[model samples]
Structures are given as C-alpha cells and as structure tokens.
Target: DVKVTQSSRYLVKRTGEKVFLECVQDMDHENMFWYRQDPGLGLRLIYFSYDVKMKEKGDIPEGYSVSREKKERFSLILESASTNQTSMYLCASSLVSFVMNTEAFFGQGTRLTVV
Candidate 1:
C-alpha cells in the first residue's frame, strides 16, 4: 500500500516564524500536492509538483511554497508564518493510470497554529 507520511501531526508556532512541513511517499507517484483545509473554504490547493525539479502553483499560492528535489519527497514551506495562516495542511500523492483512474492518497495532516 502507498503511504504518505507527514513530519508532524501538530505544530504550534509564534507569528512571523518560518515553518517547514515535510511529506514523503513510498509509491513513486508522479504527482504530489499540498493543500490547506479551512472550515468554510474547504480544501484549497497551495502547490503541486508533477516531477522532480518541476512545480506549479495552485489556487492559493500566496503564503506557501513547495520543493520537489526528489521524486518521493515534497516539502511545503511557510515563509514567515502568520496568524491567518493557521489551518490544517494536507499532503497527497497520486498517479495517472491510463487503464484505471487513480485517486490521491492523503496524509493524516498537520494542524498548524500560529499565535
């Protein structure tokens, strides 16, 4: 089975702190994504990388950034965290299969709180 592992399950940080959230997948999938989940806004994509050393910004890319130096790992970085950025962050990976549609497998998520 494919597994997405997040570095931290919960995090508390002071305002203006820099944060790094790590994610790794063992399935050798081609795509990886980062999303922030808020109550009303639902899951909003922050960034995604389709291959090593390549990435595309998703809808909400203002305060978030991503790195994909390797095929199995993707990292999300908050460059100067803020109070409004407090939310649940999820990491997911998937493969596009021509024979059968594949679904993205999500991590348990890392809930981040900025004070």
Candidate 2:
C-alpha cells in the first residue's frame, strides 16, 4: 500500500512545551502538508513542503513550524504548546504538478491536548 500515516495518534503536552508530530509517506509524493482540524474551523493549513528542505507557510503558521529534510518524511513542530493549540493535526501527501494535481492521501489524525 502506498501509505501516509502518522506515528502518533494521541499526544499530551503542557503549556510552554515543545511538541513534534511525525508523519511518513511511502508513495514518493512530492508535496506534503500539515493542517489542523478544529470543531468550528474545520481544517486549516499550517505548513506545506513541495520538496525536500523546502517549505511554505500555510494559512495558520503562527505557532507552528514544519520540517522536510527528506522526501518521505515531514515533521510538524509546535514551538510552545498552548491550550488553544489543542486540536487534531493531519498530515497529507500528494503528487502534484501544474497540469494535474492528484488526490491527497491523509494520515490517521493526531489528537493533541495541551494543558
């Protein structure tokens, strides 16, 4: 199976703690994205990487950051955890191009709670 999956399904962090959410994709996809899912806000992009060591800030990148040192792995970092940052984080991968972008494959959601 061409897989995109998170390493962690649940995490708990205290305020001011740093958190890392890990994901790996085996499809050799060129694009990977991080998004957060909230009850009212749905899914909002936090960051995306189009290639290794290259990344772009997404709609909600203020408190979050990402790393893509390798093609198959993408890591999301929360510099300092906060109660408001508690939410479901999702990782997605897609093979994309100007001509035709393919459907995104998503990992199992990670539920993060900060207290």
Candidate 3:
C-alpha cells in the first residue's frame, strides 16, 4: 500500500533550537509536501518538492525549510524553533498530475512542541 512515514510521532524542543522532522514515502511519488496545521490557520503549506533536489516554498515558508535529497524522502527543518511554531506537522506524497483531479497520501503526522 502507498504511505508516507514520519520518523518521529512527536517531538519537544526548547526555543531557539533547530529541529528536524523526517518523512519517507513507500510509493515512488514525484511530489512531496510539508505543512503546519493550526486551529484557525488551517493546513498551511510550509514547503513542497516536485522532484528530487528541487523544492518550492509554500504559503508559509518563513520559518521552515525542506530537503528532498531522494525521491522517496522529504525532510522539514525548523530553522529556529519557537513556541509559536508548536503545531502538528504533516507530510504528504502524490504523483505528478497534469489534470486537476489527483490524490495525495498523508503521513500520520508529527506533533511538535516548542517550549
């Protein structure tokens, strides 16, 4: 079955520390994404990569960055963790699509707490 796997289910970090959240996909998908979810802000995209070694900054990329060194793996990095950054982080993988109709598979998610 197709799936996205997160290296950690949860994380806790002190303010100003650097944090890394890893993701891996079993399916050989060409597109991968990282998002941060908050109550009102909804699922805001942090970063996405369409191909290996190629990345695009998403809606809210100010404090986050992504690495797509391999086709099946994507990593999200918090430059300097802050309490405001505490949220549920999600990783997703999908096939490249020309048409609008396409499906994305998501990881279970990693909840990060910045204190």
Model 1 residue pairs with clashes: none
Candidate 2 matches the true fold with a TM-score of 0.95
Residue-by-residue lDDT tens digits, candidate 3, 58-108: 999998888889999999999899999999999999989737577999999
lDDT, residue 70, candidate 2: 93
Candidate 3, residue 43: Cα displacement in angstroms equals 0.6
The superposed Cα distance between candidate 1 and the true structure at residue 26, in angstroms, equals: 0.5
> lDDT at 47 for candidate 2?
95
**Lowest lDDT 10-residue stretch of candidate 2:** 95-104
Q: Give the candidate number with the greatest lDDT.
A: 1
Candidate 3 ranges beyond 4 A from true positions? 98-101
- Compose the digit string of candidate 1's lDDT tens values, residues 31-113: 99999999998999999998998999999999888899999999999999999999999999999552457899999999999
In terms of lDDT, which candidate is stronger, 1 or 2? Answer: 1
